[model samples]
Target chain A: MSVLSLISGASIPVQLVMAILLLASLFSWYYIFLKVFTLRRAEKQTAEFERQFWSGADLTDLFQRAVNARDSAGSLERIFESGFREFTKHRREPGTDVGALMDSTRRAMRATYQREMDKLESSLSFLASVGSVSPYVGLLGTVWGIMNSFRGLANVGQATLSHVAPGIAEALIATAIGLFAAIPAVVAYNRFAGDVNRLAIRFDSFTEEFSNILQRQVH
Target chain B: MAAAAIHSRDEALAGGLALAMHVLFLVLLVFGVSWQHKQADTAVIVDLWRDLPSVTPPRVEPPPPPPEVKPEPPKPVPKVEAKPPPKPEPAPVVKPDIALKEKQDRERKLKEQQEAAEKKKLAAEKAREAELEKKKRAEAEALKQKQAAEAEAKRVAAEQQKARDALAAQQAAAQAKVVDEYKRQISAKIRRFIVLPPNVSDAAQVEFEITVLPGGEVLGAKLRRAANSTPAYDAAVERAILRAQPLPLPPDPALMRQFRELNLVFRPKD
Candidate 1:
């Protein structure tokens, strides 16, 4: 049998396995590109917001800009807005202490930080699962195919390489496709996960640094 | 909230990109497979039965007679078939109604002229009697023809069965003859190489099991039964067998099946 016939002639279970692996590969590539664009955008937005924050822009003006930019605002900008809004609301109270004001502001910023991180982290698990499990699915197809080929050998009077070559070839295609689907997924997952971690550290440091600024102003 | 909206747009974009990439990948996969397929598609046809240009003389005789006999019967069958239609068609035909109708018309005109009603009625009654007799005779003849056709069909069927049985027996005999012919040729070739030892007994026989390849090369020759004659005669026979390196074998694979492991009985006297 030829290469084309080998795939088309594969047993039903093997075909099913190949189909699942193909779909996994397709969706994983989709997420890989999507995450690439998204992570790049997040990193770019965080860098722009950080530059503007450290440029000594007025806090009230920055807060107003963040609110106006609402949907387009980056993770760091949103954390800054939530923290400034908390500080302003507590300052209106006549007897509110500096420690309590800073505490409430940090809390609001931390909450917004967590939500932004969640948004970035979405679908990363899907890539991880596909990367880790697709090889085994392909292995199942290979094992089944080899078993069927050997079983056919039992009926033949003379066992030859030609008898088993096609079946084994068809079975191996499963493993090849499995690796094909998994390598990119695993690679993309590691790259994106590392990028997201870097973003998280940046957001955490900004939250502590912004609290220090607000603490000095209140005192 | 704005992130979700932007995320949806990204999702749509990603979906479109994914679908396009998969389509491209599938096209590449199909093209690659079919490309590699060009070389693999060529088929090899092995010729199991090689035509023997030198061995044509013996095979020329047996096949012609059966073919000649088979073709001869069918050739003249259609051309000389003049018996069936004329014999059955002429006997059952009777035109009594036309003659009776004309007579009645003539009698009616005559009766009207002569005013004889009694004579016209009697003639009508006689015409009816004659028509009844003719119909009865036609029915009997038709029944006889149908019975004769049934008998002819049964005889033809019996003859066909006998012919089929004879053909099967002839095929079996032809196959046996081919096997015997190959065996004798192999024995003759080995005998030509024989340098017989003197003073061998008339009853001394040496039988060997000869195994041959498709190309008539002797793969092996083992002594199954040694000649009770002197050691020299036995050695001479074995030497002659080995000297006949490539034996004579039939070109047909079906005939070769019998010659694969041949039992050659070497009788010095005969």
Candidate 2:
């Protein structure tokens, strides 16, 4: 039987299930695309910002640059700006201890790091849910279809293959569509999750390295 | 700062490109897969039985040979009187000449009678055989003629039946067309007379049976179903059908049978 026939011949529940799966697949794809672009940009911007930070530019000048171009600043650059801003604010206090000042700067940077990570992790859960649950939804539709087809057999005196084949084919379509919805989502989720994790690690290491530089400058 | 601004612009451009790519991929997948599936669906399924070799007809058993007629046995030849003791050499001194000549003549006459009887019996046997052969030939000719007549009658009857069937189908089709045309005309006339209240929001349908006379006169009208609960609407529909008096009907009396008890449904639209 043709795909069209399989879809049209499916029971109402099966059709509804297929429709839901299709919508899920579409949304997953949209997120998959948007995340890919966002993650890649974050990585590139982090690398560029790191190169600029280490190019012997004065810390005060770098902080000014980050603030002036705040809208376009990378996540790593924003962390540096917040930490440096706190450092300069505390330094003007005549009796501020170096240890306490360093603590406040680290706290500010850590807060910014988490907010950026949260942005990166956004929508990853949705993709994971789609990947894991769509197949079961499709399975539910298939089971319903098969049950209906078998129930219909009670009306017949003798069941033949032709009588059962179309129903089964229609039922199987739900599973096929479910798998279609699931496979891509699962793949995209795994790949994006790995990318986000790697970016988070890079951001964490940059924060530590920047704090070490500040410690030396304070001395 | 300038570098960060430029990087952001690049990021936005990359996102736009990625979205376009995905949209393109989606369109291709939907159209490509469905189109391929449709092509596969159109494939023709050939019945293997259609190509099977033709079957030979079963052999018919030959008829049993005709009963053999036995020829009558020839009659036995009658015995001739033992030739009178070869005329004993009659001595000229013992018998008179007249007596000797009379005795020889009597012997010849008896031999002739025996030969004539033998020839007559042979002729009678030949005549009986000829009569039997003639009777067999006549019976065979009569049977052949009877079988030919029967086959001809069957063929003629089949042809006549086929012609009658074709004529009946043609008549039925023509009558149906006439009935449909008349029904359309009647509906159109009734539709012109129907009037619905302007405030009614929904379309309404009224089903009723109308009885008509042979000359296209409306004899009675009865409402069978009404979509709305309003009695006025049902009554209005009944009145419209009645006003369309002498519902258009085919002139053919035979076609009148259909219109005699017709079920009419009216759906009034704005």
Clashes of each: 0, 0
Candidate 2: residue B106 Cα off by (Å):
86
**C-alpha TM-scores of all predictions:** 0.53, 0.50
lDDT tens per residue, model 2, B1-270:
365565566556645664675567556655667433334456686423222222222233333333333333333334333332233343344256677676676566657655666666666666666666666666676667667666766666676677667666666766776677678778878878878755554667778899898867788998888876366667777888889886766656766778899888877662
Which runs of model 2 end up more than 4 angstroms from their true locations? B1-58, B61-270
Q: How far is A154's C-alpha from truth in model 2 (Å)? A: 2.4
Per-residue lDDT of A64-108 in model 2, one digit per residue for the tens?
A: 989998887888999999999988889888998888988998999
Model 1, runs deviating above 4 Å = A1-3, B1-5, B33-270
Docking class of 2: incorrect
B266: Cα error in model 1, Å: 35
How displaced is residue B37 in candidate 2, in Å?
11
Poorest 10 consecutive residues of model 1 chain B by lDDT?
B68-77
Error of 1 at A75 (Å): 1.0
